[model samples]
Target: MTEQALLLVNLGSPASTEVADVRRYLNQFLMDPYVVDLPWPLRRLLVSMILIKRPEQSAHAYASIWWPEGSPLVVLSQRLTDAVRPYWTEGPVELAMRYGEPSIEQSLVKLAKQGIKQVTFAPLYPQFADSTTTTAITEARRVIREKRLDLTLSILQPFYDQPEYLDALVDSVRPHLTQASDHLLLSFHGLPERHLHKTDPTGSHCLKTTDCCQRAEGAVLASCYRAQCLQSAAAFAERAGLAAGQWSVSFQSRLGRAKWIEPYTEAHLEELAAQGVKKLLVMCPAFVADCIETLEEIGDRGREQFIAAGGEELQLIPCMNTHDSWVQALVTLCRRAPQAL
Candidate 1:
């Protein structure tokens, strides 16, 4: 076996909780063709419109959740890297962001300079999507190709339904379940529904109806983000031994007016409160490490909304960041030989 370096990647955050920094981050994030998927000219126009007022608003949001060290996403990702480094005795471990500094390019360059010949890139997203897992892997391959680096690269498969991943997720939430909670909500990041059609290999299985994603098969599961999210939820609930009605799933952080995957997180929070759920346990499975979305959108504001709507307590479960089981799962995922680019 060749000596290999491990690179962990996650969605990025603004450089700082400032308007200029946030604007710069948004530009890089939104300009990705895979993310917006519109024609270049139209995408640029839409992004420009969004930047006009979004930066100020987004900067505030970032500020509300910003950790004293830095963005929670970046900090927690680094912590995960440190935790996994000891296990990866084969080579060094490094962390990168899909949209900011400590970029994939730089991480790869560092590995190359260390005379590492094999690299296994682990995208921190548990479920696959064009914008998240796909884009991160695509960018890494691009850097290798364009830079002419003499290195072999492998990428992690989405671990949504992987037994180890499911088990780790279950372990992370078991302690929470032991506490008093009326409901458990599994929230994955939202993607436009059209994204499924664009990725579906059969072209006829996605969004045909409410049950289509639930019955996804073969290549469908590989590309169907919603189906993978749902799979994770079902597996988790089963492993945790929760009754059918005790837990449910929802999507969060939707952008644009285009129809996104249904059961929005905020709406579900309101619904749970209305249903007289006094104690709610909200878990973010899409993220291995908590970010602004988990900390602010779900923890801070979500708690406020749930209480205002009529709830006693809304507890945001910490993500599987640096957990012993999660670290083991990462090791096993990275241990696989280079399978697909």
Candidate 2:
């Protein structure tokens, strides 16, 4: 049997939490056109300014979340790769980062040397975003075009609302969602409002108006992160038997001075606390693995803010990292893709 290779790609982290390494990682990550979406010179100027101060701040954030083993994102991804490898009878499994080390090109090259011709590129993002999924796919294609290798490539479509994924998400958080909590907050990472408007086909697709995204369908709003996020929350809520008033959606991890999609998670927490909500359960469905965003921003700072705002318990449910059900879901998704080459 011709061997196939499954390459799982993720948004990467710096090799270490060192300030210099963090700066380098941020420079490479923020410079991508899909990421910053700014003109080169201006982007460089802006990044350089941010790098000067952001790295030390970022390094501190990372240190708070850094696992004894390594970056939680990298460690968990490797664990997922290991778990799925035994199930894939026809292929080898590899992990790649979209922006840091073990890049897409390097992973493909390694697989090629191992006599693997058929390759499947699985962007680990559950939702499809030009910045996340497209960047990874474009890099893989660029490598293929440049090398003129005999490799064939298959990209995994985003499965944000996949039933298997929903099941896994529900299973991951079900244990923590008792009736005691005042409410459940399904928070996702926010994108700039400009990005949604820039990418929307009809321009009116995302008015940021109430219920606007709830009414959108088809490719008209495919690139709208807000729409996908809402859908994911709805799916999980439905499957988890959450009542309408019991759960809500919010966005987090916003950077810069520009306005981003709302309602913001931090603000929402304050509002909930003010509204007499004492205990809360928070879930970051946008992230498949725990990182600085989840660890420090949400788990630590977020929790602290919630308590300070008059809330009692702010319990953070962990992401489905290397969990058996999630691993099985990922392997099943990969197996369904046609073998390339």
Candidate 3:
């Protein structure tokens, strides 16, 4: 029997809070064609323009959330990796970042050197998107081909609606919902609308209407990010005993001017505030690890914005980072994943 390895990958963070480090990270992140989805010249020009002042501002945002140990994203991911390692008796477990250090290339090479021929390439994204899942898988394949590594990959599909994943999410966040709150917001990360259509195999099904996601099925549902997100929220709400009106879904972290899935989170905060929801609870189900987006973007800035808009308070339910349930759920998912090559 051949040894089977597990490699967990996440959206990376800047190596440090320094502007230079942030710039490097952002450059690598935004320059990816899957992320920017533009022609080389156009993407380069757009990214270059963004690099001008975005890095300094981004550095400040990262600094606000920077854990003393290092980036919260990386630190928490490593912790999750550590927690899962003890349970994976078949082979070694490694962690990698999509854009930064301990890259997919480096992780694969390390596994190959250890005589591990089969790897379960798990991208820590609940929802499927070209920018996240596809890009990570693409890079792994690219490295395997370009470098001619002998390792074979068994990729884990997005587990957005997996029972184990939903169980972990509900169990982890149930306590937060029990606290006094007027509304619960399931805030998933935003993606450009074009990305959805570009990925739509049906081409005519996605973004067709306000209720299109509910109607999504078969091939469309499998590839639809919005549908998967809505499904995750619906399943979570059902399990948590949240009434339809008690919780609503919103998309966050919109970038550039391109139309993104909405209602936008920032605007939704004000909407909820205006509706006289005095206390609010927000859960970013899209992310399993609490990173700058969750900590600073939502926990910090979002709280200020919500409070200033007449809401009394906004609580950000933390991600299931290294939670015991999540650890076990992840192990189950990995064990059940389809093995390849």
Cα lDDT computed for each candidate against the true fold? 0.90, 0.87, 0.94
Residues 152-263 of candidate 2: C-alpha lDDT, one tens digit per residue: 8877877887888889888888889864788999989888888888878887767757888898788855777788888999999999998899889899988999998899
Residues 1-341, model 3: lDDT tens digits? 78889999998999999999999999999999999999999999999999999999999999998989999999999999999999998799999999988798899998988888899999999999999999999999998899888888888889999999999999999888778889999999999999999989988999988899999988999999999999999999999998999999999999889999999999999999999999999999999999998999999999999999999999999999999999999998888778555
Colliding residue pairs in candidate 3: none
Q: Of the pair 1 and 3, which is ahead by TM-score? A: 3
lDDT of 2 at 277: 89
Task: Indicate the worst ten consecutive residues by lDDT in candidate 2.
Answer: 332-341
All candidates: CA RMSD (Å): 1.1, 1.5, 0.8
Ranking by lDDT: 3, 1, 2
- Please provide, for model 1 over 257-332, each residue's C-alpha lDDT reduced to its tens digit, 9 standing for 90 to 100: 8999889988999999999999999999999998889999999999999999999899999999988999998899
Which 10 residues in a row give candidate 1 its minimum summed lDDT? 332-341
Q: Quick one: ranking by TM-score, best first?
A: 3, 1, 2
Question: Model 2, residue 286: displacement in angstroms?
Answer: 1.0
lDDT of 2: 0.87
- Cα TM-score per model: 0.98, 0.96, 0.99
